[model samples]
Target: MACLSRHRHHHHHHHHHRAWLTSPDPDMLHHRPLSAHHRPLPHDDALPPLLRTPHPPRLRHGRHRPHPRPQFDGPDPIWDAVRQEAKREVVQFNSLCASVASIAFLVFHFNCVQAEKEPILSSFLYASILAHDCLEQALVFVLANRLQNPTLLATQLLDIFSNVVLHHKPIQRSIRLDVQAFKDRDPACLSYCSALLYMKGFHALQVYRIAHALWHQGRKVLALALQSRVSEVFGVDIHPAAKIGEGILLDHGTGVVIGETAIVGNRVSLLHGVTLGGTGKEIGDRHPKVGEGALIGASATILGNITIGEGAMIAAGSLVLKDVPPHSIAAGIPAKVICGLQEHDPSLTMKHDATKDFFTHVATNFRDEMPNG
Candidate 1:
C-alpha cells in the first residue's frame, strides 16, 4: 500500500523586515517592533532645515579648514566692580574736603563783610591798603626774627606761626572772635584792620597765643623770648602760661599785666593799668580767676587767688583782695560790694563811672560801718 500511494508536503518560513524603509508612508515605522540591541535614529525631516543640512567646508589656499573659536575683548566684571568702588571712595573723600574748605571760606568771608561795613573800610581802595599794611607788619615780624637768628629756625618761624594762627581751625576761630570783640567793644577801634594792626592789646594777645603754643610744645626759650618782646613793644605783659579766653578786650593795653597763673574768662574787659597779680611772692595757682564778662576798671588791682564773679564791676582804682559776688558793683579801698547791678554786662557797656545812687548807697554803708565817736 505504501509503494502504490506516496505524497510529499513543504512548509515555507519568511523573515519580517522594516516596511517604512521601502514604503512612502513613514507612520508605519511605529507599528513595527524595535530590536533590543539598537535604537531608532531620528529622520532628517524631523529637524528644522537649517540644522538638518550639513555646513560646507571653508576653503583656504584650496584646502579645507574648520571655523575658529570666538574671542572676548571686554573688561573683566570683577575688575570693573573694584574700579567703581575706588571711584566712589575718591568722590566721597573729595566731597568731604570741599565741604571743610567751603566752611572755612564762609567764616573768613563773613569777617571781611563785617569789616567792610565799618567807615574806615567802606572804600574798597582803603580796605586794600589796609590789607597791604597788615601784610607789611607781618613781614616785619618775620624779618626781625630772621635778622636775629639767620638760621632755619628763624626762616621757618613765619610759615609755622602763620599756619598755626591763620590756618589752624581752633586758633583761627579764636582770632576771628577777638577781632569781632575789638570792633564791637572799643569806641576807638575803627575797623578790623586797625584792630589787627595798631591795637597793642591785640598784638600782645596774638604774640601771647604764639608763645603759649610754643610753651606747650616744649619750646620754652622761644616762648620766653616772645614774651620779652611783647613786654618791650606793646607794654602789655601777658605771661605765656596765662589762660586767657576768647573775645577779651584789653582797652588802652599799657600797664595791663596778666600773671603766669591768671585765668581771664571770655568777653572780659580790662581797662589800662589793670593788674592781675598774686599777693607777695606766692606760687602755685595764686593768681586771680576772672569770671566771664567781668569789667575791671583802670588801675584796679585783683590780688591773690580770688574769684572775680561773672558780670562783676570793679570800679577804677579799687583794690580787690576778696571774692566779688556776681552782678554786683565793688568800689573803694579793699573794695566792697556797694550795690547790685541793674545791668549785668558792664564789660559790654564799658561803663566805669559811679552813679549818684551808687555814691549815696556807699555813703550810707560807710556811715553805718563807722563806730560811735
Candidate 2:
C-alpha cells in the first residue's frame, strides 16, 4: 500500500509537463509542453548552435521560465539517419504496395469481367490498387532529386503530399505547382521532372536509378537488362538510349512509341495511340523529333525524319510527313498548318474548335494526294 502511494506521488512530479510549452509566440520560441512527448523538441543549453540561446518559452503570466532549457542531449544523429532511411524504405514499401495493388485491381477487374472468383488474388488486389498511385507519387518524389534541393524539395514534397487532403483542386494544378517548385529548386530537374510528370504512372527513372548503378559499376549488360524490364513493365516504350525532358504528359499512353535516337524536349504531351515512327526501310535518327510544349494529339502519327517544332500542335487524328513550324496547328491525313495555337492554351479555346470545315477541306485535298497504298 505504501509503494502504490509512493508511485502515485512520483507520477504527479512530471504531470505538470502537459501544459508546459503552451506559449503564444511560436515564431520567436517554440514552447513545447514538458513531457516524454516533447522530447523530440530540444530543451535547454544543449541545443544545436543553430537553435542555441535562450529563446525561452515564457509562461502565460509573462514570467521568466522556471525550468532550465530542457537539456536536449539524446537524439542520436546516427539513429536519425537510420530513421530517415527507414522512412524512405517505408515509402518504397508503400510504392511496391501501390504497384502490387494496381496490378491486382487490374487482375480482379479482368476476372470480374469473366465472372470468376479470384479469391486470394481479389483480396490482395483490392488492397494494392488503393495504394498504387500513392506509391507512384511517392516514388516520383524519391527519384526526382527533389530531396537534394532542400528548399524547393520540402515545399514541393509538402504540396505533393498535401494533395491527398486538398480536395476540389484540379490534379493538374497540383502537378504543375509541384513541377514548378522542383524546377525552381534545380534547373537539371526540368528534364527529369518533365519526363516524370508525363510519365507519372510509370516508374522509369526508379528503374533507371538501379540501371545507372549497375552501369557505373561495370555492369553494362545488367543495367541494360533492367532497362528492358522497365520498358516492358511501364509500356510507354522509352528507349534506354533516348534522351527525354521534364514536365511531359503521356496521356492514356499505351501503344505510344518512342524510337531510338529520339530527342524529346520539355513539357511535351503525347496522347494515346501517338506514334513517333520511321519509314520501314529507314534507320538511324529517322524518327520524329518532338519539340518542347508540343502536344501530339491522340492518334497523331509523325513518321520519318520530321521535326515538330516547339509549341506546335498536332491535332487529333493528324498524320505528319514534313517538318512542322513552331506554334503551328497541323492536322488531317497529310497534316497542314490550319492555324496557330499556343501549347499552354487548352483545346476548348483553340481557333480550330471554330474551324472544323477547314480541316475537312484539307483532309479531302490530302487524301487525293496519297498514293493508293
- Residue by residue across 1-373, what tens digits does model 2's lDDT show? 0100000011112112211112222221222243432123223233222222112222233553222322122221211222222222222333223332212211012223232332343322222222112223233333333222433343333233233222212222223322332333323333322334334333443344334444555777755654564556555565555555555555555667776667767656676677887878777778888787677777888888779898788888888999998887888788888877654523212233523767767679989999997
Query: Candidate 1 — which residues are off by over 4 angstroms?
Result: 1-157, 354-373
Question: Which has the greatest TM-score?
Answer: 1
On residues 316-350, what C-alpha lDDT tens digit does candidate 1 reach at each position?
88899999998898887888888888776778788
Indicate which candidate wins on lDDT.
Answer: 1
Q: Give the Cα error of residue 199 in candidate 1, in Å.
A: 0.8
Question: Which window of 10 residues has the lowest lDDT sum in candidate 2?
Answer: 1-10
Model 2 segments more than 4 A misplaced: 1-201, 204-220, 342-373
RMSDs, each prediction? 38.8, 18.8
For each candidate, the alpha-carbon lDDT, in order, equals 0.58, 0.45
